[model samples]
Target: MDGTFDREHHLIAAAHHLAKALESTTDLNHDTKWLLSDLSAHLSRAIELGKAHRAHNSSTAEIEARLMSAAQTITRLHSNHPKIWDAGHTTISEYLKAVAEVQRLTLSLEDMDLPKTSRELLDRAQNTLHSAMARLEDELAHALIRSKQGFLEHTEYEDSLVSNEDDSVRTGRFSSSESDVGYETDLVHPDSIPHIKSIAGLMFGSGYGREFCWVFTGFWRNVLAEHVAATLGFEQLSIEDVLRMEWELMNSRIRKWRAAVRGIIGTHLVAMKRLFDLVLGKYGDPITSSACLVEASRAPVMRLLNFGLAVSIGPHRPEWLFCLLDMYETLTGLQPEIDALFPDETGPSIRADFHDLLMRLGDSAMAIYRELENHISLCSSTTPLASGGVHPITKYVMNYVTFFVDYGETLERLFRAQDAGPGPNIPDHLRSLTSALEANLNWKSNLYNDRPLKHVFMMNNIHYMVRKVRESPVEQQFGDEWVKAHIGKFRHHATCYERETWGPVLDLLRDDRRVGKSGQKGMCRAFAAAFEGVYKRQTRWWVPDLQLREELKIKATKMVIHAYRDFLGRAGSSVCEKHVKYSEHELGTYILDLLEGSPKSI
Candidate 1:
């Protein structure tokens, strides 16, 4: 066939050359010109025959028949039954081969007019290719859906967020090796990737790239939403929902949201991006893969972010401050992962949204923290505690401030970021808050009518505050000096309480030269009455700290017992037994029973 075609091409060229020579020669006769014209017409006919021969051949007929058969197979598999996956490997292979052949024919016949039969065959090939592509599209989606790894378990996410005490935020950088390991566990199954790539390549090459991307992105988007909502237990929360949610419930959800953010951005979205690249990278269009990934992940990512945003913009209550800090820290921790996952055309917008949420949370947290001073200063009790024990406000403020100790570093960062100039740090703010609480406590102590009870109230509250600061991380914030200083303040209050309540009682035991026999009896009665009254009144005053209570009891007992014994030695011979209402041993016992927080009478 090659030799015959070459011979025909040579004959035509030779005849054309001879005719051109005959026409150019002026000496040539009319007969020669007539012969040249006939030769030209024959050459044109031969050229037409050559074009027809090239356009239609034995191989072309066979290819058309194969395409028709392949189209029939595809139509049968997809039309009524739609069991493309049930087809044998040979059937699939033949269908793919037929599509390849159609591509070749289309390329070869480009820009050339085709005969009716050839055109019809090409048209049938196109229809068959479309059916095959449609089936492949379904297969791609099915494979993706079937092979997708399950959502990262909520426990797994929670565990990831749990870090050492030093690493309160768990901002550990993800190593490539670690990410690859995680991706392997969460991405599309290895076996499904090649099949996906094959389908994606064919569809993209066949002018169905947009359709392929649409299916991929749409499926993953819905899958992501389902996994977030149903599997991971994160729902889209509007600002109103967040604002109205009770703290206990909102707190639980915030924890879940933190975990979900880590799981989705750190694990799931990363896996999705890897799967997209693996399936579509074969076509070597990174933009399409990235765009698809962004499209698939944006809604779910924003859904998670919207929850954070809602929480951030909600009321900055002190109770919600820690949870807000938790949210801020969670996003701060996941920033690296977010940057890596969304580094594309749309990355900036997503990153900006995330950053905005972080800022809002930080701002909210700082607002709550800064308001602590006002909260403490405003916390007051019109009715003093009758027992003079630790005040309710004292417990609340101390515990609240102590909680900030754990988030000291986070608070420092937030404060520094929010600060435009030099301002109070965490310690300063906490100290100020403590000062406000102490001032409020002073005002509350005045509510007590008895002077001694006022001292007891201050002693109890100040001592409790000092102990809390010493025992908790709040100590680190306030320092040893602050603890010592507060310790001194409580001790001072204890001294004043002893002086005011027991000083006059001790004075009654002083020996007097002017005491006659009746004077001795009267003095004894006065001392006994004062002792009983003081003991009975103080027993009602509560010393919540066991060590402090024991110390105060021992001191008071020693002071009263020493004085009473001395006075008894000096006046025992003068006073009557009835006038000495109590013995030294009994008197000491009564003194030791004071400050037990239960009222008693002798």
Candidate 2:
């Protein structure tokens, strides 16, 4: 009361007293609460007095003194709930309500003559409120931690109802007030605290909301930074395990971030980007840049590839490779959306993370291919062909090479800019390995006694390899040139088969002495012998593709028919009436049925 007569004197004493009180009181008390309530009411009265006295042309010092009293009073009130403030029990709405009240007091004096006091009081009130809000921000940050802790496991964390996709599934941490209303009628646990979302909503309302957005984004950046550091710091995990775990974690964060932003309106994009920069920008180190707390993500993606592509050539050849390819594609496909969320102009490009991820994936795939090619080159071809009629190595190679076919467009887009060309030297290595395989097939065919039969084996396998590569995305790597080259080789093999097996029969048909000499029937017996030997032998062999089989059959038939018909017309009935068992026409007809050899003949 003694200091109250001089307004300036009162405000100075109030500030000093309140500051001291706040420093001294570490515990909650009824006395402190009453003192705060009284001070708040007094400030309200002082604001009213100042506004009423303002239009009377009071001195600047006198008016300033009154407003300063109110300002100091509000600042004192901020320290009132020390225990609750320290414990983070102060709700954001409650804090904002107090700020709004103080703001209203400051605004009431807007038309007054006390320019200095009005500005000073308003600044002081706003600053005090900001300090209180800062404390509230700490609470909100803790609430996020609490929400995470409420879930016993990461799976439960995923199941939390705070998802941007589905807001109706109310988890206790984010449920609406309406959903929680029934808690009052039921046996009460602790009074339900405001949900994290409700608190966030209050903090984000209208005036000064932008500042809180910065704070909010900064908080999440720190949170995510810690998450990344923890994920990467798996000291006990194998490098492979560390990589896999980090991949899963990073993927989870990206997905959650994506889902979370779905509910965010376009207006909030700037704030969202700030958060993105904290998590993904190169310079967003948390401790140094808390206001813009961004940390660049260092994903253990290469190790993920190493584990995924560790497949050998024997049995599990491409399955592991396929699984990784799937992951690569999935991550690749999600890039645009995730990138849109966290774009940074001055920092590293938004697309850099995804681009790096894809490049690493390509490198991993190339590494796998190199290992597989080495394995293919060293492994013997003596292993029986797999059940699919392709040799084990051939099947493995085909599968490995074609695994990325579905991702052709993506790869082209990714590597399209490569001035040095697609390296890891994958395409050329694969082509050379394929040629080696062909040579190996030729060498292996020597194991068979019959020349024609050996060529058939070569034809079947080469045809299989060519067909697989032709139909798949492997063509992207191997190219049209490789395809045409292989197809030509297949044609050459078919021609060789005709020459080795059917050449003798056609030659005999054209022999003039064979007409009746030594009772050797002209070309009829020659046709029978050749058909019985070659066609019957082919009948036992398996051709996997029906389309290819038909083509081979047509080619083989055409070669024999023209020559046989010409010979038959030349030799005629003169040869037929002698030692020839069948007429010339009958001989012509028999060669037609060559591919369908009998089981006895076979």
Candidate 3:
């Protein structure tokens, strides 16, 4: 049966039709510009709505295809108009590829019963998309550097300007048609400077006052904000907060950039004028390039710095800048370093395997939280951080863990769906996700720090308890039924780890306490250091040195090892939160005993 066009696909087809129509017509009519822009917007809404609906792979593929087709049309226009080359190019081939990469990796693919041919066909689809994007970037980058007329014959753009660019504005490099505009081709803000060039396209020699605001309001603002939220592991943020932080930075960036361009034009008019036209002559009008997509985060980073750095960049700005530079270098450089993580599927990276595990443990905890978060506060009214209160972040952390675990499960489900063929199965997908939870839990217990999981358990318990009291007081307001059952599930889950993983460690800490050993303080310091990290607190380091951080790290490592050694001797299979209760008598007494220098060994 033919795959029928869904709502999103229909929208995409309409958008592409509009793009094709505009791409072919050189006269540039308001109806076409407005129509194409509206379609672009409709495509955006379709993508957004589709994501909200968990649209099928075909749906996404269709949208990407339409966008790519639009990209191709715009690429042709680049020869005639150079500024569109930057903005349109990134939106299409390069940036879309990265977005597709994320979307593709999320599918579950294990246990699929697909015929070999079907499997190969799926892989070929991915390869085709990836290869086309790669080719497009290389082609556009070279095309950008070449000298050209109204456009190189093969190049194109639908004039992705707010108002249409006049073809006369682009005279051949050989003739002195219009005064050469001077500008910096610094690649400093490649993502942004293109729109400013659109303004130069005006028939009256007037530019769009802020053409970039179109991209900002319409595209990168949403993408970057989404990226920030995903990276930071936030599920929800207040609209006010987002506007104050994310939107403010974006607006600030535009303000700075416009003013900078105006300043450059005023101070170095001849150079700026020539540089502007030179850019137009070479790059043409197109959307997307690997080079540009790689630099997608740069404009945002610079924007972040312009707003954030002013607060503290004065003292050691160079070091911070080096960090930023290093980040870019690693992301672009290491992207090609890994092939796959697991041996059988040959998908995911070694790091992805680890991320999967973390996700699993994170989710299991959150599943329990969903049932228990509100009512836990009733059992104890105390928060995590208030002198002895907990943090709200623990809830998010657990949920984020759930998300990662779900990512793993989603991958597994993909394999299953592949095997089943025809209909995609979701329940199988969820199972694939939770499979990583147990393994991830074990991995953390065996972290390089080598401390006992009891230490972590204690920290989590404290944080979880705190989160209940402070943020989720709703349970306190209601009678607890499902909450108790929820806590029961966590207790049952905890029993699964009742083995000697942290038992020896717990015993060691207990013995050190019994004889009044001095290791307790050192241990707490190390644990504090791990939880808070070096940035916030004057904490111990995992590995320290007198060169400052190195010395501190060494001391911290010793302290942690000492604590671990003591705990290892005493930790046992009986180790559970039920057996463990911390109060002034049990925990404080032990620490006090250790300080008195009783028996040293656990």
Candidate 2 lDDT, tens digit per residue, 1-602? 32354575457457646745664665858787667657656665665565555444354445446545644654555567543333344433455455455455444555455456357655664565566556556665555444432101121122222222221322212223212211211101123233444444444432444454465555554543444334334222343542344333533433333222221211122333443333323332333222232222222222222322321111223223433344344455455544554445422433464456556655554445446655666666564332214465566556555544444454454454444365334577568778777777776777677776666667777887788787766777898888888788777776787788778767776766444544346356666666667555655555566676667666666766777667556665666566455444554454444433233342
Least accurate 10 contiguous residues by lDDT in model 3? 155-164
TM-score attained by model 1? 0.78
Runs in model 1 deviating more than 4 A are 1-28, 41-44, 47-54, 57-59, 72-112, 154-185, 230-234, 282-285, 400-419, 422-426, 472-477, 504-541, 560-602
Question: Which pairs clash (backbone N, Cα, C closer than 3 Å) in model 2?
Answer: 278-294, 278-295, 284-294
Best by lDDT: 1
Better of 2 and 3 by TM-score: 2
List RMSD in Å for every model shown: 6.2, 18.0, 34.1
Give the backbone clash total of model 2.
3
**After aligning candidate 1 to the native by TM-score, how far in Å is the CA of 300 from where it should be?**
1.5
TM-score of each: 0.78, 0.42, 0.17
Best by TM-score: 1
Q: How good is model 3 by TM-score?
A: 0.17
In the predicted model 1, the residue pairs found to clash are none
Alpha-carbon local distance difference test for all models: 0.75, 0.49, 0.33
Model 3: per-residue Cα lDDT at residue 222: 40
Cα miss at 554, model 3 (Å)? 32
